[model samples]
Target: MKVAFTAPMKPLDHPVPSGDRTMGRLIVRALELAGHKVEVASTFRSWRAEGGEDVTREVKKLALTHAQEISEQWIERGDVPDVFLTYHLYHKAPDWIGPYLCAKFNIPYVVVEASRAPKRQSGNWALGFNAADAALAQADQVVALTNSDAQCLSQVLSKDVLTVLPPFLEEARFEISQSVTKGSADGTIRLLCAGMMRAGDKQFSYMVLAAALKQIADLPWRLTIAGDGPARAEIEPLFDRKRTEFIGLIPWQEMPRLYRSHEIFVWPAIREAFGFVFLEAQSCGLPVVGGRVFGVPDIVEEGTSGLLSDEGDASALAQNLMSLIKNPHKRENMAAAAVENIRKNHSLEAGARGLDKVLHAALERHQFKRKAHGGR
Candidate 1:
């Protein structure tokens, strides 16, 4: 099968590293691993951070023009895709190209991680909301990355069209050769957190983490944060200068070693969409402690691979951390379980199999629809 992939929120090759970009690349890789030829359909990003009627109109116009040009090129080159797959579709970054291109070529249109927010229907993002809603309605298959997203999507689309595909990682990419033991010889528990230091949700998460660390000040632990962004000035002050080390922006290739060297992965993942960092950290045999919000629990199996505290509760987070810090045996056992859980559930092979099943069903559904509509 030939899949034309588009990520309207962030392109796969975008220089600015982020979870969205990583997930976009992973989706393409998963499709390829499923024995499908995948191509990035376009790099035209439709994301609008701020809402304005004029801005929304201009973006929609540009996206239509871009879609027309792409369709022309595909027709000329005889390279029309069998399936058009769009990732991370929402009001902020609605996909205008995939549906247009699929209609033009009579191919199956699928959306991965499609989120619908009803509150945006009558606000500054009204146009974007409408566009996204239309795209979801036209989609042959809507892949939700989390159950919460699936529930929201079900309100607009038929339940039969929506499927929940948990976030997955390429386990081989983060695998280390030698065995990594938790805790240092100095008897200090090394904690790791990798996330962009930005405002809004991230800043709030950092605040919670800092507060939790303060509660556990008596423990023998050190935190190493690996990320940099605009909110660094505001977020850095939240942590204790002596206990925290800020290592700005780790490269993708070095993340495995960073995870292995650390004993515990601690992050108050407030409102996170099943953090990829959790999967990456657990794959390297490190126990995790995160906030029980959104999809964090989906990745970090509570009591098995890691522990979760109530979202935004610093004291709860501190207790969870203290539990692991006070007991090395429990951490070691959870570390082993973390690695096994990732290999069995979140590996690339498992993700590829899931993609294969859904995409083939989409193709079959499109065929049936076309045949029922007089073979159009």
Candidate 2:
């Protein structure tokens, strides 16, 4: 099967490195791994970070124009895709192309990691909300990245159309020695965090982490943050300069080594939609500690592979951190479990298998429906 993929939030090859881009690339890779030919449908981003009605109107118009052109070109080349797949569609960045192309070509439409916010039905994001709702309704199958997202989507989409596919990693990319030891040689617990230091949720997560670290000041641990962004100046002062080290923006290839070197992966993960870092860290055999909110718990099995504290609760987060720091035995056990958990449940092969099943079902259902409608 040939799949036409589009990510309205951010293109898969976007120059800036972000979790969104990473997930987009992962989806493309997973589809290819499933033996499907994947083509990126468009690079036109529809994300509107902050805008009024006029700004959104212009973006929608531009998106529709791009979609029209792409459809015409594909038709001219006699190479329309068999399936249309859109990733990460929400009110902030609704897809305007996939549905149009799928309708024009009479192909199966699938949406992955789609979230629907009913509250945006009549607000500044009303246009985007409606557009996303329409796309979801038109989808032959909607793949939710987490149960939380699935629940929200169920409000508007049928339960039959919804399926939960957890976030996954390409395990082959991270090669860690099975005999590698946890923590540094001098008995210092090495904690690592990898996230862009931006304002809003990222900055707030940093503040929460800083507060948690302050509570465990007496513990024998050192934190190394591996990311950089505009809010670094504000985020830096929140932590003790001596105990914390900031190594800005480690390349993607080097992240696995960084995770292997650390004993624990810590991130407050405020409002996180299932962080890929958690999967990456665990794949490298490192236990994780994150706030218990949204999809964090989906990846980090509490008391099994990692620990979770209540979202934004510095005290609880601190206690979770201290528990791991004080008990090297527990950390080592969780580290082993983390690696196994990802291998069994979140590996690229697992995701590829899941996609193969879902995409094939979608194609069959689409054909059945079309036949029922007398080929429309």
Poorest 10 consecutive residues by lDDT, candidate 1:
175-184
Kindly report which residue stretches of model 1 are placed more than 4 angstroms away from their true locations once superposed: 178-181
Minimal lDDT window, size 10, model 2: 176-185
Clashing pairs in 1: none
RMSD of each candidate relative to the true structure: 1.2, 1.3
Cα lDDT of model 1 by residue, 94-121, tens digit: 9999999999899999999988889999
For every model shown, the clashing-pair count is: 0, 0
lDDT of 1 at 103: 90
Candidate 2: regions farther than 4 A off: 176-182
Please list all clashing residue pairs in model 2, or write none if there are none. Answer: none
